[model samples]
Target chain A: MIGAGVLWWLSAPDDITRPYAADVTPDIQAGALVFAAGGCASCHAAPEAKGDAKLHLAGGLAFDSDFGTFYAPNISSDAAAGIGTWTLEDFARAVTKGVSPQGRHYYPAFPYTAYARMTPQDVADLHAYMATLPADATPSKPHDVGFPFNIRRSVGLWKFMFSDTRDVLTDAQTPQIARGRYLVEGLSHCGECHTPRNALGALDRNAWLSGAANPSGKGRIPGITPAQLDWSEADLIEYLTSGFTPDYDSAGGKMADVVANLAQLPEADRAAIAAYLKALP
Target chain B: MTGFTKTILGTGLCAALIASAGFAASHSSVTNKAVAARHAQMQMIGYHTGVLGAIAKGEMEYDSAMVDAAATNLRELAKLDGTTMWVAGTEQGATDGSRAKAEIWSDAAGFAQKFTDLENAASAMIGAADAAAVGAAMGGIGGSCKGCHQDYRGPKS
Candidate 1:
């Protein structure tokens, strides 16, 4: 029995293993669309005001915080400067496990908590798309973060406290509701902006979707609760489609860019997002 | 004699009716042209000031003197009665405009408030050519513009 158990454990596929070959067909292409709907570029790429087309995802974008300055790293596939040496498994592990190839923990600044719920297939598809991009060999800049944060190993404790390791699976609920849940928990990454963080930089689940001060300090990231905004599904859909609410108000700053991307998505997906946001507690 | 007399009378009536229609059409066309010209003038003023205000505020800084001249021209253009120029049915048809939102018509009062805010702020900037004061006024103008644009302008992807 002990020998059989060991053999089974050895043969069993791990969380990051692909059971089949990578799907690079149209379904994966559709997954790419879903990835865009999730707004990956908004944070990963350098910040520009509305409508400036530039791709600089070899991340040097800086964020100022009470703790210290954190610089996002180059995610390009360059072997030396970027993730070029990273295999599909390495990419999946980083996205789902929040651990780098060197066994170092990545800060939640990368939003891997939300990405943890992403389907392996979707993650693999994203990896495939990223691999096809031109490799930028820009050297990763060291984070200027101070004291406790500079100690990268400390992030393991942070992950233990905050990260959700479960993959999102659809229950026998209404399709619309399930879709909304998938989007909110996985791709949309609403909590990154909406949920308040504790002192240790972990999200306060009690204040989930309760709105938080904008990290950039420009303004408040508004609460999406039905109580706060009183927005109907139609209103939310229109806002997502045109960047204008039914009440004649429009989103600005980062949200404007979000809306622009959302507009490109199919109407049903936007509706699903609206449904999800409206159902939030 | 009876048929010939009736034919001549019918022709005369048709000619008179055509002449009257032509005269009315010409008159309406001229009126429309005038209204269009006035609307264009107001739009140009708004556009020019918007660009100039960006420069004055240091959000953008290009040729200062050229922007100053543009501001001056905007002030001259603003002399026209904007309310009258943007006639109800005609405003939607204006071109080279991405700033105007469909909500402008749906929520006229709110839209007017934003427009008034913009006009007042812009006029203040134009009145005081001092760079610092212009920057302050530019903030007000930018606020109003952004307030409206946020709600109305289509997303820029």
Candidate 2:
């Protein structure tokens, strides 16, 4: 235990620094969209909150899975229970690297693997936006995972095996497709649930969005890649915009919430997501 | 669509039409009977809702003719006799081709309430005339769909 603790101390996260953008007083407008795109409220808000009450980042929703129940943290700006005192670099590292302000590793359930792909500017904007949200003094619920999983240092090895920080498709010729890829792969993290995972809980990139068994241990998640799903771009857009799939199958499950979030985005952004999926070869 | 995609689409279309016709109402099978029937109906529901959804989401130019057509689709589907589609042992685990939860069979009263909710929402949407009116009704429609799905349907496979 002592050896592992020392190694954990030695394996400090290489924190990412925010580029000094002292002039552009954080774009709250863009950040609002960023917050929605990240679907932060789906996990962070009090489970039954609605209307404006959803803005409270109290964070106590229980995500029941095979591993155990994992509770989201109080991300509101509370100095004691939330991320109130975190600097931009602290926030960036926590989101992008799954490292805490105190340099401990976080569980993968936090979805930092996908958030790591976000641009520094977007992360900064998100930070600025989160600052505006109301703080909650509610204490975070503890996760119920057992021994090995509870050991925070073990996440370092997991990160080494599965972490990815690059854009899903940075080389796309069209900016629209690139934006689509960003939303689907980065902000939305659609592939996290849509694609099947290996034994390690790492996403199987080869079958990206090709479908998978629900890790939460109930039913199947459909494969959504163009090769597997035959819907046209328009059909796909309609689905994202309103949870209706081609052949008239309405989205159920968690996707219903995801579609709800996507609906908040502009029509053009939803169209871009569809175009990106269609362009997949 | 090509290969399996084309095959799947064709199968879905055929199953929906046949199920709507009720020719296979008396038929029973170990595979591809009740599940296919319900899926087909759901697809038709999807088709109708897609039109309204498109307009509501700003994916299509709103037209009165299209709105009326979609309303007709929802109204017709809302009244369809889908009770026969629920064959025994056809939920997510017992069957291979569906994500319908076993709870749909077990929780009879709950499922009925959800069905009734959808019917009411669909009825309201059908009465709507303009795209704006239809849009106003979309939230209730989505909520009713999701309410049932929360307990009775599994994630899509």
Best by DockQ: 2
Query: For candidate 1, what is the DockQ?
Result: 0.05
Q: Chain B vs. true chain B: TM-score for each candidate?
A: 0.46, 0.72
State how far residue B77 of model 1 sits from its true place (Å).
12
How would the docking of model 2 be graded?
A: acceptable
- Candidate 1 per-residue C-alpha lDDT over A181-275 given as tens digits, one digit per residue, 9 for 90 to 100: 77776777777777778877777766767788778554467777777778789878867865544322346656765776777788888888788
Q: Which 10 consecutive residues of model 1 chain A have the lowest summed lDDT? A: A47-56
**Which ten contiguous residues of candidate 2 chain A have the minimum total lDDT?**
A16-25
Angstrom error of the Cα, residue A232, model 2: value is 1.2
Clashing pairs in 1: A77-A84, A249-B151, A250-B150, A250-B151
Contacts from the true interface found in each model, as a fraction, amount to: 0.09, 0.57
DockQ comparisons of all candidates to the true complex? 0.05, 0.35
Fraction of true interface contacts that also occur in model 1: 0.09
lDDT of 2 by residue, B23-111 (tens): 23322332667787776666566666666665665555555666677766776676676589876677776776667777777877777
